[model samples]
Target chain A: MSQFLQFLFSGLTEGAVYAMVALGFTIIYNASDVVNFAQGEFVMLGGMVTFFANAAGIPLPLAALIAILVAVVAGLALNRFAIEPARGASVVNLIIITIGASIFIKGLAQLVFDKRFHRFPAFSGDDPIRVLDATILPQSLWVLFGACAIFSGLWLFFARTLVGKAITAVAANRLAAELVGISAKRMMALSFALSAAIGAIAGILITPISPTSVEVGTLLALKGFAGAMLGGMGNPLGAVAGGLIVGIVEKMSAGYVSTNYKDAVAFIIIILTLLVLPTGLFGKARVDRV
Target chain B: MLAREEASGPAWLSVEGLASHYGRIQALRDVALTIAKGEIVSLVGANGAGKTTLLRTISGVQPASAGRIVFEGEDITTLAATARVSRGIAQVPEGRQIFGPLSVADNLRMGAYLRKDGEIAVDMDRIYALFPILAGFRARPGGSLSGGQQQMLALGRALMSRPRLLLLDEPSMGLAPVIVDQIFAAIVRLKSEGMTIFLVEQNAFAALSIADRGYALETGSVILSGNARDLLADEKVKEAYLGI
Candidate 1:
């Protein structure tokens, strides 16, 4: 039982990070029909930029803030320079463009930040919290709290605010949105910025535990995509739940089975989910309007 | 006989020598027309005609490859669609393209998205009164509405913007005759209340019967335009569009 509890806590912590990335994917995917494959790089940028900035003598908090802003600029630049220019391109073409962007960002990071892995001290002192005979890191709690706060904040934004509704509107019908004076382009930019910021926050939260290298984003992005697929692509709660399921499954497999199978868990889940529940756990049968 | 009534004074909206292309295929060619304040102007055509394309160009969704769109004398030919909405131009697109997942009330709220005034609530109430069925379905998703109700919702949505110029494209399409009458009556009522309307329809007789002026389009160009009554009685229009 204690062993199970330990794995659960570990799973939940990792799940929180994956859930954040999945949520980021959901936002960009909703606003623009394009799945931004570059989402993981935003997380890497958050960790790497903050670590280097801190090494340059900046305070940790300020470094994290600067890193977030840098990710945001990168997001906006990706939209303006790549996505907007290919405005009417097919969905497949746009996905390719995002993949290109991911590759480009990864290359740039490799050059600017070097090939070494990076980490920073946790926000709070490194201490373990015991619950039911299982010990969990204090930083895990922060990661969980940060994710819940973001999810709740976004839920309120979408349900209560006009800007939030506008995002929903754009996701529903681009032509109708434009007819009502909602700038779809601006909304797309906002989606990119918001998703990028969220990705950076997840990176900041996770770095103390996992550490980050330039290539860390590739696996993270793939796992995040798997989580989003499991959750149902467009729904928020699905993303979080899907991510948690993924992390738990991975940790459980590693504990009981082998660490060798841990990394393949997400990919296998993605494939099985696609073959079985293509619309995801939370998605509906959508009748697309032409 | 067609008597083209050229723009005599400062028109409410004017399109001069407008042309548009979808790739290499020209969809609208040298289409010049004008609408005055507080009147109904209809553009009538057959299935292959460029009526929808022209309406899209005026609404700034489809780009014009040549010519100018002047609204109250400001050249809006190159303005973005959102900017055109901000400048008091609203379009009820073909097929009553309501945001399917949005509630009926939310759909109307989308129309007033750019409004900063406190009158939004007031205007919303007025629309509910105008289309009483919508008031009952305020909490329902817009896609669940019937065809006629969706058309009413689209019109109400456009009106929520308090637009000076309303561009409607084929509102009567795919609706029952009774619903068509209700929509046309609403259009007439709006004209009586001093709204400038540019209506495009494949149902030529109904359109021209309510319009003060009419333009006949064929194969992507304006072939004849004159007083609605004259065009309604003309041999070419009657045979081609009115099915007389």
Candidate 2:
């Protein structure tokens, strides 16, 4: 029973990270129809930069803050230099641009911060809290809480705030949204900023358990994209649900199944989900008007 | 002509040589038109005759290929759509583009998004009064509304902006006759309340019935311009658009 509880807690913690990454995918996809391949770089930036900053004597929270700001600026730059100039290009071209951006960012990270793996101290103390025969790290709770808080914050931003609704409108119909007086470009920029910030938060929170490296972003981006696809590309709630599901599945496969094939399990589930529910579980099938 | 009779009525908006394009296709070709304060100016045409394009250009959704757009004597040709909305220019786009997932009330509130005044609440009540069915279905998703109700919602949204110039594109398409009458009645009410309007419609008879002035467009140019009553009576317009 304790083993089962341990697995559940660990699964949830990993899910929280995936959820944040999935959210990043959701926001960028909502603002621009392009599925940004470079989204994982934001996560890497958060973890790697925060780790180095802490090692260089900066406080943990402040380091995380600076890392998040940097990620946001980088996201904006990605949109401006990489996405905007190539606007209305073919889907294949868009995919190549984002993949190029991911590679470029990874190369830059390697130059800026050495290829050596690094870890950061958790926000709070590193004590494990025991619950009903199961033990869970305090950092796990931090990650879980952070994911929930970010989701709630995003919910309020979209439902209650004007700017958020403008983003929603743009996602729904760009031409109509423009006719109704919303700037599609500004909303696109805002999406990138929001997406990168969320990714950075995930990286900062999880770096204590899983150390950061330049190449770490590629896998996270793939997993997050898979999670977002599982949840439905544009559905925010679906992204969170998808992330948690992917995390739990991966952990179970690693525990009960072979640890080496854990990543393979995620991809298999993605393929199955795509085959069965093409629009995703939460996404409605959108029909084109003639 | 009604426009001549209403000449002393203040000039509320003007479009001078307004041109627009869709990719390589020039959809609007050097169009010039005007709407006086408290007047309804209708642009009538067939599908692809640039009726929708003209409304889109005025609202700044489609960029002007060349020439200028003036609203209340201000050159607004280069302004972004949102900027124009804040400047009191609003449009009800073709096909009644209501936010499908949003609640009816929220969709209406979105129309007044740029309004900083405290009277937004009052405007909500006014919109509700104008479309009682919408008030009743305020909590329902906008997509649940029928085609005509959606049109009403779109018009209500534009009115929420309290716009000096309201541009409507094809409000009567795909609606039942009774609903079309209801929409036309709402337009008449708006006109009676002194709102300047630029209406685009393929339903020339219905559009000309309420319009003070009319411009008949073909391909991308205005082929005829006159009082709505005269255009409704013209031989060419009768054979082509009015179905007489």
Question: Could you give the C-alpha RMSD of every candidate to the true structure, in order shown?
Answer: 3.6, 3.1
Checking candidate 2 for backbone clashes, the offending pairs are none
| Tens-place lDDT digits, model 1, residues A118-207 | 899998879898897899999999999999999999999887788998998999889999999999989999999999999999999999
Looking at model 2, residue B126 earns an lDDT score of: 90
Q: Write the per-residue lDDT of candidate 2 for residues B139-171, one digit (tens) a residue.
A: 887877888899999899888877877888899
Candidate 1 vs. true structure, TM-score: 0.96
Best candidate per DockQ, number?
Answer: 1
Q: Best by lDDT, which number?
A: 1
- Tens-place lDDT digits, model 1, residues B26-145: 988898999998779999988879998898898888899999999988999999998999888999999999988888999999999999988788888889888899999999889889
DockQ of each: 0.53, 0.43
Q: What is the TM-score of chain B alone in each candidate?
A: 0.95, 0.95
DockQ of candidate 2? 0.43
Which ten residues in a row are the worst by lDDT in model 2 chain B? B1-10
Candidate 1 residues lying further than 4 Å off, grouped into runs, are A287-290, B1-11
